[model samples]
Target: MLCATFSQIEIRGKKGRTVPVLLTSEIESNIDLLLQHREMAGIHPENLYLLPRSNFNSKEPIRSTDVLRKYGKEANLCKAENITSTKLRKHIATISQVLNLSRHDLETMAEFMGHDIDIHRSIYRLPQETIQVVKMGRLLSAFDNGTIVQYRGLDEITNYLRFKGGLLTLVL
Candidate 1:
């Protein structure tokens, strides 16, 4: 399907969920190359699957885990064995959370990711200690500056974090 400028391909994922995958130009070119190679090799024009097995008649899905791990080793990514679909999904979930979308927008994102908000956060959105430290520092700084929100009872905390104690130690 078409979206904005890039192409979006919808496919059935686990549990019959509809998953939309966007193809960048580089990935599109790679797919084109594969199709060209398949055509040159005299593969059946009516092949039912995109990444058909070497047998050509098997209905099995391509093993992207093996491909990703091999590519990771060649590209010097983290441990090759760690390259996996779940890792990629978790990365997308966790990274998208950093954009600070609204609750409604997050729900839309969760829908697009084929999961509900609770499952998305609990299963994929892993907590990073460094990120937590940075966010806490920023929150404390905002409170200290009285820029985030003005709450009556939070004044004590704000006053305490206004560089008086070691409560707010942000170098950013």
Candidate 2:
């Protein structure tokens, strides 16, 4: 017998625009954990797995308004007068910086936080010495085949590569 690893379906908005929402393996594992917790709580094995309510107000079908009230309180923070999604996004960005995330990690976090990766990179990516090194590498690698001369040392090789004008054609 064979088993499948996992699968995903692409989600689209009402306008038919594809959303960049991709679930990691962690999500499926967390759902399995939730199911295990539900079974431990004495929910019937047959009914052990069930979707949360659209409003997610209860662990079970209870009429208590406490969960709803809590949700309302949290929602009030994003209310027009108090805070905006933009503000919340800025807070998350700051937290990402404080945590010292790398560029790839920041991209993942931005996706998790429902922000544009380009915007996150623009705001959070610091200019580092590695960027200059990469630029220099590109500059050195742009020479013609004839321009690549054998040299005694790495510095001489680098200088020969960086040499411009008729020096490159003369080597041919």
Candidate 3:
């Protein structure tokens, strides 16, 4: 996986929902470096594990929650409360709504987040303040300029977004 041009991991979250998460370039590089360090740490190919325990079988991962918490703390530069994985997931979800994604893109993103599209909309979409401050501002501007339309669904909103707000074009 380290030598590959791209890498992705399928994370089975709660409720048996699986999400294929693509690694960014920076994260991929870190993974490659980690694997190299793992080899240096005497974790042989016969018993391969990225985060292998020193005296335990290599087949099992080091499942200590503290490891996640440690990284969560480091990443929480703002010193926010309860910087857990769930917070990270929700942060990704809330911000993603403003991308003005097309219907297919939204579905793909929702599936990649290990939830149904409806769930994504109902629970993960940005709050009203964010929408009102950002997206709705653009909508209001377009409406004032007589460039808006009367659309009923997300797809129509996406079309309107294309001409008003810059839209996100996801390839993966």
Candidate 4:
């Protein structure tokens, strides 16, 4: 993360892109609490980082691993050791399937994750069950909304969704 204002996060991204993403209300509230805590603790308000390194002399943001480990321990959450930056990114990529995002949306997500879409699709390969659920969920959603009439037959739909743990070109 690069910087922050009251409303948004400015990412000095890994891919050399600087993007300002607005925070959700819930996350914004958490940030407010953090700001308040920082203020009470005499953290200078002028510091640029949203999650600053504890060392006052350092300009670097707090490490992702440090944040994960600290929160995991404080929350008494099991397997916090398993929570990592890569795992968090993969979780975002995987859980986003339930949203049935369009190609453009997926591209945006990949970019946000500091990669190209091809890498996202290939490297973030989800489990077979997750893939199956997403594909079937799409089919069911289409059918429920009467878009299934666009297809000539069930075979076509089945073939369209036959994602053998690889790219399945979406059709409607």
Question: Which model, 2 or 4, shows the larger lDDT?
Answer: 4
lDDT of 4: 0.72
Q: Kindly list the per-residue Cα lDDT of model 1 for residues 44-140, writing each as its tens digit.
A: 6667567866565555646888788788899987677677888777788887765556789888888887887899878866467655554566567
Candidate number with the higher lDDT (1 or 2):
1
For each candidate in turn, the TM-score is 0.64, 0.29, 0.56, 0.57
RMSD in angstroms between candidate 3 and the native structure over all alpha carbons: 8.4
TM-score of 4: 0.57
Best by TM-score: 1
Model 1 gets an lDDT of 0.69
How do the residues 1-172 of candidate 2 rate in per-residue lDDT, one tens digit apiece? 1124444434443355444544457777886787668645555444422543323334444222555546657777555343444556676776455344567888777866656788777775546554444435443564444344443234423433434664542121
Report the Cα lDDT for residue 91, model 3. 83
lDDT (Cα, tens digit) per residue for candidate 3, span 21-101: 677788878878988787566565566555666454365556646677677677875663566667777888787777767
Per-residue alpha-carbon lDDT of candidate 4 for residues 104-172, written as tens digits (9 for 90 to 100) = 999988876776789888887677788777767767788689786565345526655544466544544
The collision pairs in model 4 are none
The global Cα lDDT (0 to 1) of model 2 is 0.52
The residue-level lDDT of candidate 2 at 7 comes to 43
| Candidate lDDT values, in order | 0.69, 0.52, 0.67, 0.72
